[model samples]
Target chain A: MSVILPGDDLGISTDQIETSIGPGIYKVPGIKDTKLIPINGGLLNIQRNKQGTRQAAHLESNSRRYIPQVSDMVIGTIVGVYAEYYKVLLQNFLSNVTLSVMAFPNATKKNRPNLRQGQCVYARVSSYIPDLETELECFDLSTGKDGGFGLLDESGYIFDVELNYARELLFNPGFLVLEKLSTKCMFEIAIGINGKIWLKCGDGVPIPGKSTDEDSDKMDVDYVKDLKTTLAAANYIKQCQKVSPEQFDKVLAASFKGL
Target chain B: MSSLEVHAGVLGNSDGSCLYVVNGNKVITSVVGPIEAKARQELPQTVSLEVVVRPVTGLSNSREKLLEEKIRNLLQNIIIGFKYPRQTIQVVVQFLIADGRPEYTALELNMAINSAFYALVDAGVAMYKSFVSTVVAVPPEQGSSLIFDPSMEQIVASKSHHVVTYSVEHDECKIILLESNGLFEMKELKNILDAAKIQCLTVHEDVQRDVIESKLQQDYIWKS
Candidate 1:
């Protein structure tokens, strides 16, 4: 696909009756038929649904700021804790979003899930109103259940990537970036389209908890390994964004050197 | 022939930034926007633009303010603001070096507009069209033709200088702004704008397209 700059007429005319436009596309509203124009410089992606009647078009660009969009799964840091809700920050220097205590599954007034500042949560943007605080929830509203959306592993390390790369890591099933890392070490990762990622390897960072001296000494060795692997894995994943797939193996080796 | 160099995504913290140098003029611009807007900066139905132009030396004065206003007006026409309602896109331009006469601002404005274009595209701000600007100098000599992108020496010899801006969409260039100073006729002005149209289109094709293509290549290295 050729890169489409802003204001370039997308060669693909929107002749279809039903076309859903996505990011980086500006639609002229109140018109009889749809007229789509690219407002950002990026690769223009157009895909038809299986039925062939519906079409989806969007421009994919690498941008730093993450705008809150409904249904987008994001990893955010809890920055503000309140009685009724928690304020989460997806990216620095942007407006904060709210995660209500009751939005979590099985959360009650007295039994609300406890989350503190500096903690991370994996949640979906539940609703968005222009000029107002965005709302996030940790439960699947359609199914009325938790869909792996809640407080992330506290022992996990969180890092940032370009927004587009994070999307590819999460949505593209064919992408082997994660699979390659799995070969190096066992890890559990949550990829947020907002560019923040939570990754944990094995038992995660070593937390000093109460344990017998004999048990702690043996556990300490494994704990150190996990921490190193986690750091290396994060570095490898981050480097993947800069290099092509063929270079992934090389980057992985460099990241895990001496580990 | 004058020299031009463009480097995009140079600033680590900004959403998008470009360091553009043309001839001896150097300008660095950072575009950050559709982001959290302050109370006064917010607009009801469209995104707000905050353009700040800093001079090469000394504190910002009316000269910088005028350039800022001109940039804001030019951006107001090209940017598709409704897409980012209640948000603001901030464009900050700083001039590191200038080769033109201090009294003649045609070159400074031209450099700033082109630099801002690259910065905005780098930031990924939605816009209706891509644009470029060029300075044309009408020499005082009886048989001299309009000079495209005049140098300091040429400006010193010219009777009049004009800054022409064009918004390009679909390979077509439409005049956006024309700022003229000194004595020049409507006939010479017509030819100046006509030549500027060609200059703008060439800049968009040879300069803007090439830079964006290279940047896109790096951005989507995995795809290839």
Candidate 2:
């Protein structure tokens, strides 16, 4: 049955929630699992029952945006690094959750836990700060006798990316092909949606060909300059939209300065 | 591949401008005016929609040319070009990240178009239609039982991929453009299209919401 929100909304309408829907009635994604009983005004409300608090029944409405909640397992990557904390990207939300080094039970100054950009972690949503629209904490906390917060099982690496970078990876086929081509090496490159790339290796060796030192700085500069020139022409073509096939050389030359 | 943040207000004082990513790759875009067209390119009583894609670091090359043609065709189908005579609307989409998902580049193309259109609306340009676009995928492992708005991981893990594009105005079953390397029955195609159509409707609604909110924020909407 097609359950319609007011104004024929596919899900919960922002207007209806703000003005019309009462407290007893709610729209949730998995509410039916509880088998809620019908109450006054056609509202389906669930009451506490004998079987250890019957599961809450939910009917996901299209308009409802899911907010990350504590204990909710989510997949996120480290987007930013702090002295002893890390910022994580949880999809659909604007803010990143923080994981402090001290939160881990075995974390120490020498084994000083830190978040690396683009490192994906399976974390538990710890807390939310409504005023700041930020998530206060996330942890690798689990009851399986696993070592506390420092670093959990090192299954894989994660990438931190900006929104634009994520969008590009999501859409561009060439990037996937390039990664496939580069996969022979030990490192796994994680591209974050927020614009961060993280390289992780089981051997603990940093990816080859990239220097984390002064010399690498020069390489990056060269790369950015080349990128800028190529970008300028691409921008030009995009603006014109319909350049003749013959004009291709001219645009490419004008944009890619080195060529 | 890495993510990068980019933005463009308007380069060349065009109708609109955008900054986008190309699979961890980077690119920028700008739209030019609805200007008087050249004699050969002119339509006696219709406006024209043009598309161009630029690579971030190399020559125009064959691949870029192919993309420009393909994007132009897709745009033409959506745009109500006849609304404005003797006018030209140019779209520039640059490649920032060139990753493994070639078929997915069209997803970026569509996003840039939406951004450009948003700019055009802000610039007071008129249009007979508002195009709605989406990337619909059918995964390799899931067979045809599940359709998804694919993420990079899902797309990469899958053995084969199919990306479909749709325009809301041309609301017909066969109107989609499917880009895929895998095989599927016509029934699967129909199912994917149905899923995509729903997504297109959602996007259309979202765009309308954004437009309305922007107007409200600017106090452009009359209050009761």
The local distance difference test score of each candidate is 0.87, 0.45
Residue-by-residue lDDT tens digits, candidate 1, B107-207: 98998898888888888887898998999888898887788887888887889989999998898788888899989779878888888898888888888
Which stretches of candidate 2 lie above 4 Å from their native place? Answer: A1-259, B1-12, B20-27, B98-116, B123-125, B143-147, B169-176, B219-224
Task: List, residue by residue over B85-115, the lDDT tens digit for candidate 2.
Answer: 6556677776565443544454454455545
**Best-matching candidate per TM-score:** 1
For residues A156-219, what per-residue lDDT tens digits would candidate 1 score against the true structure? 9999999888888889888988888888899999989999999999878865674536565566
The complex in candidate 2 yields a DockQ of: 0.01
lDDT for B214 in candidate 2 is: 41
CA RMSD of all predictions:
2.1, 23.3
Chain B TM for prediction 1:
0.96
Model 1, residue A10: what's the lDDT? 85
Please give, as one word, the docking class of candidate 2: incorrect
